[model samples]
Target: MRSLRQTTARWLAAAFLAGAALAVQAADPAPIELAAGVYMVPGTGGEPDPANLGRTGNAGFIVGPRGVLAIDTGTSYRHGQALLAAIRGVTDQPVRLAIVTHTRQEFLFGAAAFREQKIPVAMHQAAADLMATRCDTCLKTLRSLLGEDAMQGSAMFTPDIVFTDPLALDAAALIGRPIQLLHYGHSSGPGDIAVYDPRTRTLFAGGLLEARRIPDVGDSDLPRWREALRNLQALPVEVIVPGHGPAGDKRLITQVERYLDQLTARARALVNAGAPLSEVADATAMPEFATWDQYETTHRRNAAIVYLRYEREQLVK
Candidate 1:
């Protein structure tokens, strides 16, 4: 019986290894066309790939007579170049307008590719300012997360057009409806905009509503993030383009709100009980978040941020 058990275990281990190797071998990079004008560009970040086998970012295109409007660039220059090529594949029309959902490099660095083409990049004023001041830090962190290849490919590109609040852009050439930039409070970063396409009723919510994956709260204010998500709930959205995961429906935003609620509650409970940051990190497990790629990456970092705020609150009282 012992001999049989050892043989079976070895076979099982070999089978698992073979399956993993096959999965890696089959994985392909670049974007996939989800619809006529829309494409899903996967990321090549060094971090554990998203469940979709891509990095945590997406780009979109809407072709019209005036020109093509592309939404959010990917992490590296290669990603951006690929995105532009994918857009051209959809329509020979030059990219007329490029708008960003946030200030994160994963979503903005690709804008550099569109510059010489004279495509105007649009973003919120706060994001433009934050990009100017923190571009180096963002670049450094992305380099750390994605390695040298991704770092060399990424370049800082700020928005040429800045909107203080909601602004409707009419791309006369694009096939989609006018794009609306609705400013939600500072949740993910200094600038979080809900990119709404009236025709599709699709809302490209940057990091305000991540689905399945853990929220990146490195520079987040829990209170503000909560408020921002709440504000997002009011929009009549049909589809949601998340910053980090597969595109889904309105439930994406709701699910994220629930996670934030739980994360905030857990942080409060730990602080109330006089637990140390390290202990809280060990204790807080986002049981509801089953699809997170690297559980430790976001969980520990989020806990640390919550702990910092918790300690500040305690000191105030």
Candidate 2:
């Protein structure tokens, strides 16, 4: 098997770059406390239009009486600063820890802001390694897409802490709650991890489960991803904060799993029948996902990548 870092490094290079590029001055949206102290800042799930400027993803925080833990920073330094400002307006506790949820430019870039505070950021070791190697390249790519001014204060950074398994923050001892950092093991990428709060039955699933927007498949093992969803479904989670789009119920798990299953099944069938790689797009036609944002721009590439990955796995076996 390829190293996890190698699997993740291909994520953006595989497909995300095919979409249109645009930039604008966008602020991080306000934070909504979904549970007693769990706050979420919902992103504009819409495409990179003038209105949203492609800021599509969710960032949130868990406030314990003693300290706060944030999950996934926004797309820029400005966004992270705005998020911190929002957190300050609501709570007096200091934001102590930050979690890097994925390797996407949107997910990891804003972490620089947290680093400035000497706040330690944590992520899967695979992800941190990949970020360290490609941080500069990803920054340049973001600069090109969002324009230098929009990305002015933004920077690429590696998380200070890395874990191979889940870690628990015993904030309840000091404050009143405890949070679990779960290393779900290769859903959207080799480095994906999630945050869960037992008290609220809330799970910050990261990109492992998505709502309206179809999850990206560039760095995926369809079978493993599907298995990961089943594992997440088994959790005692009431509300889920998807990596992108809005916060949702356990149904998001089913929605994303079904979509992934259908796409993988169709792609594998076509590959078995000896279909051309380019034809994987038409072969795995998904009218059910027609209404989803970025469908036209991203789906075709998703089909091709999934098909190519299956072909690769078969060769390995």
Candidate 3:
């Protein structure tokens, strides 16, 4: 017969093991099938933290006849490993390529993992240049927020391919479906790009689009961003996989445009009124987007940035 203390210790050990298993499962939720061979691994929306392990941006993969093409990787080395595991769960095809969709920290660090597997990573040259300038600092900040354990083995890497102009994968031979990397200059960010898969009519709008979330405008050119949206609006996109929110339809493009318009208009008015920069955030309150994720923080920052830009233009004139 086992002693009472031994029985209690064994039960506690089993419970701890079970709890650890649950934590792993929570970090890696199942990938959502957006189309026949396209899958979206949804992010837990909002700011990155220890709870979400910095997976605040969505990642996805497209399975092709030749192999697989991965969309944005997650925020850390562990996050990238989890994404790769999710891809493996869905298909046996090797990942032939991984695209860092934009210049966001959440999507870049994970390239390290894919590169380790001997997969080539690609990004727009402009975005890569921007990343080289400041991403090390961003990585440190993320490590402080998400903890070292979550970020271990993560490091910055140079992209294998960088192109200035729009590049199209040989759809007929590579993926069995057309995939285009669309670049609209200096819009959402430097060299912001979107991936369009024609067969699925899916648009992977990197940092260029958001749904039910306040778009980050810290590095945006409002006018150029709007122009890019106009270009995207003409696409035959049936589905949109945004940077930070749930995947949706073409209406996501319109929603982003509306937000940008309203924000620019409000900020311009404030500048014209000679409202001080300190008052921009509070003065340009967006009640309609009050319920959106990061409205309080991101929206306020955006308002201030836009106000300053308009203020500068006025001074130049």
Candidate 4:
């Protein structure tokens, strides 16, 4: 098994280079309203490149009579600026807060744009710590891959609000639109969190979930991630704005859960059969998910990761 550092580096490289050969395409970054006051700016899914301008992650906003709450900032300062413009185009309400949902590069770095606007940024304490330790390196990688011009003025900043527990925002102040920030300990990442809007039954499931795209397991704990998905399933979610891919209904949650389960089962079987770690990736291929984005890169890595994890579990037992 690869060391965590080496695995992370490999994952980062693959993640950035996954769909590099495809023709560069641009999509409108305009916000699409999901409900009365909820809107999502869909990402151009795939690896970050000059074509996508690193805007490969979904960002959203919940507008209320009092103010607006932005879901994520985006990948770079320019991306964040585009998001802020999208929000402005819809409403003149002051942006009360901006939430950095997780530690992923696609959802971070853009916080600098929000901070420049004087909008306070919020993050789970764990996510903030993870960012503190690794985002500088991530930023450097982005600059190298996306170019300095694309990443111009993009930088990291400390979150203005950090919470370690589940937090409930003032729905009444938000004009009857209740928003809940939920954290499931160390699931998808150290501090993966989801934003739940009860009124619209919309969930801005950050790093905790993905639709279509393979969930990156580099920093994941499978059992805990499964548990977290179970808890989310209990919610009355009607729509999900995933960390990647287009918004979908409750089924997105189930799809992610199913993928994780299958990935774990296949990896566990390989480990139980005493298969060499080097062969686990090729041996554990799932043709069922072959069409999903990053299946070629992320899924193969996920299989090896789960194999190593289960192998370690057996040793300690």
Q: Could you give me the TM-score of model 2 versus the true structure?
A: 0.86
Error of 3 at 112 (Å): 1.3
- Measured on C-alpha atoms, candidate 3 has an lDDT of 0.82
Stretches of candidate 2 off by over 4 Å are: 1-25, 48-54, 168-176, 314-317
* TM-score per candidate, chains pooled: 0.80, 0.86, 0.90, 0.90
Residue-wise C-alpha lDDT for candidate 3, range 1-317, written one tens digit per residue: 97644543443344334333433434684677766688777777778888878887878888988888898888988888888999999999888888888999889998888888988888888999999999999999999998999899999888988878765444235555568888889999998888888886778899999878999999888789999999999998767888877776777888888889999999999988878888889999988889988999999999988888888888899
Query: Which scores higher on lDDT, 2 or 3?
Result: 3
Clashes of 1: 9
Give the winner by lDDT: 1 or 4.
Answer: 4
**Where does the lowest 10-residue lDDT sum fall in candidate 1?**
45-54
Flag regions of model 1 displaced more than 4 Å: 1-39, 44-55, 140-153, 168-176
Report the C-alpha lDDT of model 4 over 1-317, residue by residue, as the tens digit: 87644543443333333323221465547677776698888787888887888788888899988889999998998888888999999999989888888899999987888999999888888989999999999999999999999899999788888878755444335433578888889999998888888877788999988878999999887789999999999998767788987677677788998899899899999889989999988998888789988999999999988898899999999
**Model 4 vs. true fold: TM:** 0.90
Report the lDDT tens digits of candidate 2 across residue range 53-118: 446677889898788888887777766777788788789988888888888777777777888888
Cα lDDT, all candidates = 0.66, 0.74, 0.82, 0.83
